[model samples]
Target chain A: AQSVTQLDSHVSVSEGTPVLLRCNYSSSYSPSLFWYVQHPNKGLQLLLKYTSAATLVKGINGFEAEFKKSETSFHLTKPSAHMSDAAEYFCVATKGRDDKIIFGKGTRLHILP
Target chain B: SQTIHQWPATLVQPVGSPLSLECTVEGTSNPNLYWYRQAAGRGLQLLFYSVGIGQISSEVPQNLSASRPQDRQFILSSKKLLLSDSGFYLCAWSASRDSPLHFGNGTRLTVT
Candidate 1:
């Protein structure tokens, strides 16, 4: 079974400050991890993905996440939080050929101006 | 450059009504398709998936059903709508087993 857990349900930060959205995953094998963001009434956009090749992944909108095997974490981070960065973030895990995807509860990020 | 499209961006229906949502993919062949639902303020839940035409696998048991009549077309249906069926439905596809799933714009369905 593969699963993911988001460490926070809500995170608040000031504009231009660094942001961190924590995610941890559980997998029986080498699973692929992804970060997706959704704005109000909009579709989900892929932020990043982690395969066996890369431990550090960068994504759109100045976002990035690091895949750590020792800690079992793939926390999303941003160098600077912009006002348009307010959205819901989801951490997902899936194993190849298994055709299964598991998502975390989600973390709502609030950017304060 | 593969693209997926889901129809009826927003739908409002009454209880017991029949439901049908269509999805189509372009610029790809024999892609893996999936149907997912997101409840209010919740994460996505996988409902169904298909690897090829006329082949479907269900992940959860619910009032909804899925079909893959053509290589690039996937449909989600329900004989009778339920109040609990209200959510954002998303259609997605992947090039192969090792690729990441790309999602469509999604449909917001509301059952009254």
Candidate 2:
């Protein structure tokens, strides 16, 4: 089974400071990984995805994630945090194309102004 | 551009009431549709998925059911509402197995 685990349930960071949301995945084979963000009472938006094409994947809103095979990690990062970045983040994993996706519990981000 | 739309952004219903939530995708054909539920402060749970019209696959056993009446249309239904069914329901679609999912705004169902 493919699954993702978010290390933190909540993360607080000051404005303009760097942000990190850690995630580790377990899969029997090479997997596709994704990061999604959801605002209060809204649907999830895809931030970025990794499909063995590149280890470093850039996404919208100045977000990025690096996939490390050895570490079994795909951690999301941002150079600077903004108030609007305060939202719930989820890590997702799938075995391959056309496979069922599994989601992590989620990490709630709080940007301190 | 592809877009998914879910109806009844927010719904409040009494217990034992019938429920129906509809979703449709535009600018896409033969898309893979999915129904997911998110309880307060929890991860999403996949309820059902459909690869084509009249084909539905359930991921869990629950009071809810799903139907795909058209290529880009998916519906979530329940004969009777339960308090446990109160949650955020999301509709999503993917172009293919490798493509990322695009989600609708979601429906907030509150069962009273």
Candidate 3:
């Protein structure tokens, strides 16, 4: 089964500081990984996705994630945090192109002003 | 551009009431539709998915059911509402299994 685990349930960072949200995935086959963000009472928005392409994937709102096969990790990162970036982040994994996707318990990001 | 719309952004209903939540996608054809429920800490739970009209696949056995009446329409229904059913329901669609999903704003259902 393909699954994703978010390391932190909540993360707090000062404005303009770098942010990191760790995620680890387990899959039997080549996986397609994704990062999604959801605001309060809102639907999820896809931040980025990683197929078999480049390990480093850039996304909207200055977010990025690197797929590490050896580490079984796909950690989301930002060079600096903004108040608008505060939201719930989720890590998702799928076995292949045509497979059911599994979501991780979210990581709520708090930006301290 | 593809857009997904879900009706009744927020709903409050008494227990045992019949429930119906509708979703539709525009600017796309033969898209894959999905229904998901989000609880406080359980993450996004996929309830059902449809590959085409009249084809629905359930991922979890629950009091809820889904139907795809049209190529771009997905409806979630329940004969009787339960308190446990109170959660955020989201509708989503994707061009294919490999494509990223586009989600509707979600409906906040509160069963009283």
Rank the models by lDDT, top first.
2, 3, 1
By the TM-score metric, which is better: model 1 or model 3? 3
What RMSD does model 2 have? 0.9
Quote each prediction's TM-score: 0.96, 0.98, 0.97
Model 3 over residues A25-49: C-alpha lDDT tens digits? Answer: 9876668888999999999999999
Report the lDDT tens digits of candidate 2 across residue range B1-112.
8889999999999999999999999998999899999999889999999989999999999999999988989999999999999999999998776678899999999999
Q: What is the C-alpha lDDT of each candidate?
A: 0.91, 0.94, 0.93
How close is each model in CA RMSD to the real structure?
Answer: 1.2, 0.9, 1.0
Deviation in angstroms for B56 in model 1?
0.9
lDDT string for model 3 (B1-112, tens) is 7889999999999999999999999999999999999987768999999999999999999999999989999999999999999999999998888778889999999999
lDDT of 1 by residue, A48-82 (tens): 99997889999998999999998889999999999
Which lDDT tens digits does candidate 1 get at residues B1-112? 7888999899999999999999999999999999999999788888999999999999999999999999999999999999999999999998776577888899999999
TM-score of 1: 0.96
Clashing pairs in 2: A98-B97
- Scored against the native two-chain complex, candidate 3 gets a DockQ of 0.71
Candidate 3 wrongly placed segments (more than 4 Å)? none
Candidate 1 chain A: 10-residue stretch with minimal lDDT: A93-102
> What local lDDT score does residue A88 receive in model 3, on the 0 to 100 scale?
98
